[model samples]
Target: MNYDIFNGDADGIIALLQLRLANPINGELVTGVKRDIQLLEQVQVRPEDRLTVLDISMEKNSAALINALDVGADVFYADHHRCGDITQHQNLQAHIDLDANTCTALIIDQLLEGQFHLWAITAAYGDNLIAKADELATKVNLTKVQAEQLKELGTLINYNGYGSNISDLHFHPADLYRALLNYPNPFDVIIDTNSPFNLLQTAYQQDMDNALAIETKHTSACLSVFELPNTAWARRISGVYGNFLANQQTDSAHAVLTDNNDGTYTVSLRAPLDNKQGAGDVCSQFETGGGRAAAAGINALAKSDLPNFIKSVESHYLV
Candidate 1:
């Protein structure tokens, strides 16, 4: 069997989309909600199976990776997140770049020689690599209107990945990927009236409106913290809302905390756009946290640790 495993976010979905489009394959699709990064654990690999994993952090899935290799599965892995020590294995083909400006889709773009360049650009935008996406768009001679469309499409597709589980998402990431497969180019997705883009757009707008009405739970010149209820809508919008907050106040770091039913919190941290250096480090201080410098997250943080987490961010970004 052939298996394609990835994070359910825009970068992961689009990265795999580019690969499958370039080299068509029929594989068992393995993915879950955005927070479900440990997808490799759920994949039961056979010795003869081939696996392609993308967008998820290798460090978090390191054990499963070893298991797949031990079973003699040929693995192709690519990501931009923090990966712990990688071992040399004959069956493993790993493409990992930790550059803050790079994402898995862009890495695949280079491998495919830009056959699906516009889709890669959209993934970059969805991952919030805004400046990089815009630069690529311009290089390809895309008009201003066209560039904005890609950005919005990326953002909405990305928004569809957030949620405590698949129940909160408008479309399961796999279904979204299948929907996108019908469009060979990102522009075609924008032009199709019945595409997932329209459904995602309407859903994204509704979530954003609800998010904006919530006042900040904590605020400072250097940091602004917002607490969202333990509702499905809050879980669904937390990540994108953090991106929205970061874009609004380029100089101020933002933290979006979503309450979890078990008295924990799911945290999304974005360093100030003007100084995107401390978020990943800050989140890493906690056990359940991991991510890139510009953005990072804690899967489940104890309620008591909220203050300590906030303090860490303040000490890192504030004077």
Candidate 2:
């Protein structure tokens, strides 16, 4: 059996989409809400099975990966997130780049010689590699209007992946990936009246409108913090909303805290756009936290530690 295990975000879904579009495959799709990164554990691999994993941190899935390898499952892994020392195994092919500017879809783009360059660019935009995506779009001579369309499509697809669970999302990541498979070109997704793009666009706007209406919980010269109620819209918009806040104030770090309803909070932190460092390191201090430097998150932070989290982020960036 062949299993495709990927993060349910725009980067992961688009990465697999480009791969399968270039070399079509029939495989079991394994994915969940964007935060659910330990997907390999769900697949009971046989010695003859093959696994394609993308856009998830190797550090978080290391044990499952070793189990698959131990069982003789050949695995191909690609990601840009923090990865500890990787295992050297004959059954594993890993493509990981920790450069803040690159994402897994772009890695696949290089491997495929840009056969699906447009989709790769969209993934870059979705992954918040805005300047990089713009550079690629310009090199390809995509018009400004076309570039904006791709950006919106990428942003909406990315926003759909932010829920705490599949139930919180408008479309399950697997369903979103399958919905997008028909459009090998990102432009086709934009042009199709009935595509997921239309639904996502509408949904994104609704959520963003609601999020924008909420006032900040804390604000200072170097940092700003906001708290969101425990609603599906809040869960769906938190990450993208952090991106929005970062863009609005490029020099200040921002935090979006969503109530998790268990006396804990789900935290999305973004370092200053001008200095994208320390976010992953700061989040990693918590048990359920980890991510890239520019963008990081904590799955469930105790409500009592909210003050400490704020102080940690402030101290890291304020100096």
Candidate 3:
């Protein structure tokens, strides 16, 4: 069997989309909510199997990945997240870039020599690498309106990935990937009257509106924190909302904590745009937390640790 495992976010989906568009493949799609990064363990690998892993951290899936390689599976992995230590195996082909300004889709774009450059730029925007995406868009000579259109499409797609579970999302990641395969050019999705772009755009605006109305729980020169209610809307908006807050103040870090309703909270942390570092380091200090430098998250943080979480963010960015 062939397994196509990827994070459900825009970067993962678009990265895989570029590869498959270049070289068609029929593989079992394995993906879940954006926070579900330990995806490799879910698959039962065999010697004859082939696997393509994208976006999710190699560190989180190291054991499963090693097992797959040991069993003689051919694995192709690509990501921009924090990979602890890469294993050396003939069956494993890994492409990892930890640069804060780059994403998995952009890495794949280099591999494909820009066959799907526009889609890669969209993924960069969705991943919140705004300045990088803008640079790439300009290099491609995209008009201002065209650039904005792609940015909105990317943001909406990314927003759809931030739910607590598939139930909370407007479209399951696999279904979303399949839908996107129909359009080689992202602009096509935007222009199509009936596309996921339109559906997600409407949903994103509503959720973001609700988030914007909430007052900050804590704010300072170095960091700002917001607490969101335990609701589907909050879960759907938390990650993208963090990005929105980070963009608003390029020098201040932002944290969006959504009540998990189980004596815990789901935390989304973004480093200052001007200094895109330390977010993953700060979040990693707590249990159930890990991610890239610019953006990281904790799946379930104890409510009592909220103060320490804020302190961690403050200390990291303050330096």
TM-scores of all candidate predictions against the true structure: 0.98, 0.98, 0.99
Candidate number that wins on TM-score, 1 or 3 = 3
Instruction: Give all candidates' CA lDDT scores.
Output: 0.92, 0.93, 0.94
**Candidate 3 C-alpha lDDT tens digits along 75-166:** 99999999998999999999999999999999999999999999999999999999999999999999999999999988988888888889
In model 1, residue pairs whose N, Cα or C atoms come closer than 3 Å (at least 3 residues apart or on different chains), thus clashing, are: none
Give, for candidate 1, the lowest lDDT window spanning 10 residues.
273-282
lDDT of 2 by residue, 1-319 (tens): 9999999889999999999999898999999998998898899889989999999999999999999999999999999988898978999999999888899999999999999999999999998888899999999999999999999988998999998878888898889999899998889999999889888998999999999999999998888999999999999999999988998998999999999999999999998988888888999999899999889999999999999999999889886
Question: Which should have the higher TM-score, number 1 or number 2?
Answer: 2
Ranking by lDDT: 3, 2, 1
Best by TM-score: 3
